[model samples]
Target: MSHLQAHAQSATKSAVRPEHGNDVSPHRFCVAPMLDWTDRHERYFLRLLSRHARLYTEMVTTGALLHGDVKRHLQFNAAEHPVALQLGGSEPDALAHCAELAEKWGYDEINLNVGCPSDRVQSGKFGACLMAEPELVADCVRAMRAATAVPVTVKSRIGIDDKDSDEFLQRFVAVVADAGCRTFIVHARIAVLQGLSPKQNRDIPPLNYPRVQRLKQRFPELQIIINGGINTLAQAQALTDGSDGIALDGVMMGREAYHNPYTLAHADQQLFAEDSAVPSRADVMAAYLPYVEAQLAQGTLLQHMTRHILGLYKGQNGGRLFRRHLSENAFRKNAGISVLKDACALADTHASLPPHEQPDDNLRNHA
Candidate 1:
């Protein structure tokens, strides 16, 4: 293996979950709620990598739960324990109703999404727009907390537009905390609403982690999770060392999980320090194969699922061959687990390929 890959693998094996000084559960690492990116299949894949880290479902709108197929939207694997359902809404009654339904669906926690800055969300009068109305957010949190016994939490950007100030954030937290929400996942950045798109909002916003740390210091009783632009295991570990936890989204969940899955395997060993063996990409593909076939039988496109696995062999000896073979063959009519076997075979055969030829660039960019 290349030196960087070797170091990553070694770090995975040595990762340790730090003990928090507070009364919260020890699952300090969390997968952030990403729209369309953190479905059940992705959550299950992440669960295979780290058993103890908390997983969050994508933001399900309160309207969807109240009017749409709530069960299908909330469906998840049994193995994905300690999972939280993130709900998006501004209405206190609707949010409370959705939280009740999520609690009934057996989620470990109910999180409020106040961080998403999409225009569509703003038109719906929710997401980061709620940041402008702390009173409304507190009412929603209060109602949800009263409706469900599960821990009610909020995920928000540091500020929106000109409202970016410590005073705004402090009052926002204080209002919600009074409403019984104790956990706050702060995406430590100010979101620009006018010129930036939602994707740019995630990237262009300057990360102000110290502001989040200050929030933690100010409200020692609140569990503050830092999120935004944290891409490496080292970064995750370092952030969690100071904060209550670290929340990772597209950067870690999609790109990193696909490019260097071994990081997760390393996280299992180093963070959890559990002797449990990391499953090979082949093993993961084998396990997921039957599920894919079943979904296909029901007319689901392979792309829906395969898109989540494109980075499975990132940074490995035959990473490109593995990704290329799978990318080409996985969509064939009636493709099965045997396709994964072929991909693995390609990896084995091209193990001696130079690093430049092994698709690490694709892995890194996507990751």
Candidate 2:
């Protein structure tokens, strides 16, 4: 047996310890920490749509936090509470240090990334490849848990390459959970390391959700959150409401949430059972504008924020006009908040018109 396999067999399984004697924060509905997609602006926009769903920062590498400008990487708007910081690294000490930084920056949780299939992540000795070295992952989790009071969780794939078996995954979880990591977000698919691009890794491999269901059955005390191929609200609902009372604690949506962000409009009332009235899609954008103006005054490029919102009106009338207005004008020199207002005006006009009377948006079909 490999040393990690040897260690996994020897390590004793115990109940995971909570940081500060409290349970990990509820992550019943989460927006995945997509690389370029879930940056601070995108997270803030997502927050406007769902008050109760948890949000995550784009995965920050240990190198970025330890040697790069720390403030730029860690600063987030105060409105984005209940946000987790996802870190990508394999070194135990560096991860521990980064965990400390996350806690100091007021992140609610720290997540280690072991699911990313990119060659860049592989070059760093982390991501999906770490599944083969469960002992090292255990060490990193142990050090991180020791460094901060915030919950230290892990996001990992079911397997990597030819090691895609239930036994391999079970062993990995056994070792990490033994090291005090309680919450696990499993991307229910194999990460084919060699032949596919990162994009293909996300879609080409068939998702084996039943394996994740088996995981919850085996480790009932651990909070298991399932990811991969969950896009629509109905599918999220059916999966969370498993046969009988058996269910995973959460559902995390990635591309679905970004590509059709309006889908999250129903999350608060549905998944969180929140009593407050949900905001309409336009109202969500209206509320988002003040923040946009504030950011513009600070000299950040409008496209940095506007690029993420082009999909805000997906499936709505005049959605194309809204997107076209921003897409064409947002990056212009000194482009102010007027662009957003004018775009919304088009969308609102469509809302008021009768279906037959609404102008043909040829661009809408292409959009």
Candidate 3:
């Protein structure tokens, strides 16, 4: 069967639950919900590279789903199976309604965003600020739980602003867990709500993996997945490998997965113990071509899909040549799948020759 066919057929299949002891859980290696980076096209592309990793949508606000174009926010390619929809907003009724909508649309899971620290999210009284109002977050979780059969989960920080303590995190998680949330993906840092920009909040704040580890020890029943500051394969493996008895359930990678997605090509074998050999860079490009071609035929910009694969050849021999060709031509009116074809041609040539021995003209002299 074709990739598209598998994409369609797998849409209805359920992903393994991300619980400790359920090592079969596909959520062991997830690509986090990055605002613009994990849209449908990007999810579909990433799916080609690792079939086992769970993918998440860019956070769709409750207002966008209820008051704006619902289909536009909720619709996804059939191939992005085991995909979760991350919903933003604090209104219990609105979030519950959106959760119901997500279930109706066949989403595999619904994740509540209590982790974002942006001023925009603060103005709306949700995100990390909700960390201070554990009851309100619990109510939201209760309502969403009442609305869907699929798992209702949350992504949050260890704390926010003045509440950066283990006692504070314990209270917050206890209340939300009381409301029936079993899984919590915690970014192991505090959100500096007042002076810092969201980007600064991501950095500057020291990562406290030990706090998360203590939380796991405190609430062993909860599937606690760690997020934040984990950027490389070795770092990701340390947690997911489960060798140290850390008791954490999973790993949710954001920017690392986006900026260097090729790292995920090995996620299936490492995280899920899949028997298949890891995919080659060329193999991923070849598998993704049909999806890109189909999207382009549907009037989607070539760059819309191609942009996500720019890192496909990252750190490889002829990667610059591949990136230069796609970067230069993908947005052109006449640019088609041929841009990828030519890029792959360069990728293959460089894959064979030593970097110093390879002709410089190949990357610099793209035809």
- Residue 73 displacement (Å), model 1: 0.6
lDDT of 1 by residue, 127-241 (tens): 8989999999999999998898988999898999999999899999999899988888888888887789998998887888778877877888777777777667677666656
For residues 271-364, could you state the per-residue lDDT of candidate 3 as single tens digits?
7776677777777777778777887888888988888888888888878888888888898986899888998998788877875776675445
Q: Rate the local accuracy (lDDT) of all candidates.
A: 0.73, 0.84, 0.84
What would the per-residue lDDT of candidate 2 be over residues 1-367, giving only the tens digit for each residue? 4322222223213212112113323777888999988988998788777756688999999999999999999998756666899999999999999999998888889999999999999999999999999999999999999999999999999999999888999999999999999999999999999999999999999999989988888998998998999998777776677742367878899999999998887986677665666677777777778778888899888889999999988877778788888888888988889888888888887866777876766654422
TM-score of each: 0.83, 0.91, 0.93
lDDT accuracy of residue 234 in candidate 1: 74
| Number of clashing residue pairs, candidate 3 | 0
Tell me the spans in candidate 1 whose CA falls farther than 4 Å from its real position.
Answer: 1-27, 243-260, 273-275, 297-299, 352-367
Candidate 2 lDDT (Cα, 0 to 1): 0.84
Which number leads on TM-score?
A: 3
Better of 1 and 2 by lDDT: 2
State the TM-score for model 1: 0.83
Each candidate's clash count: 10, 0, 0
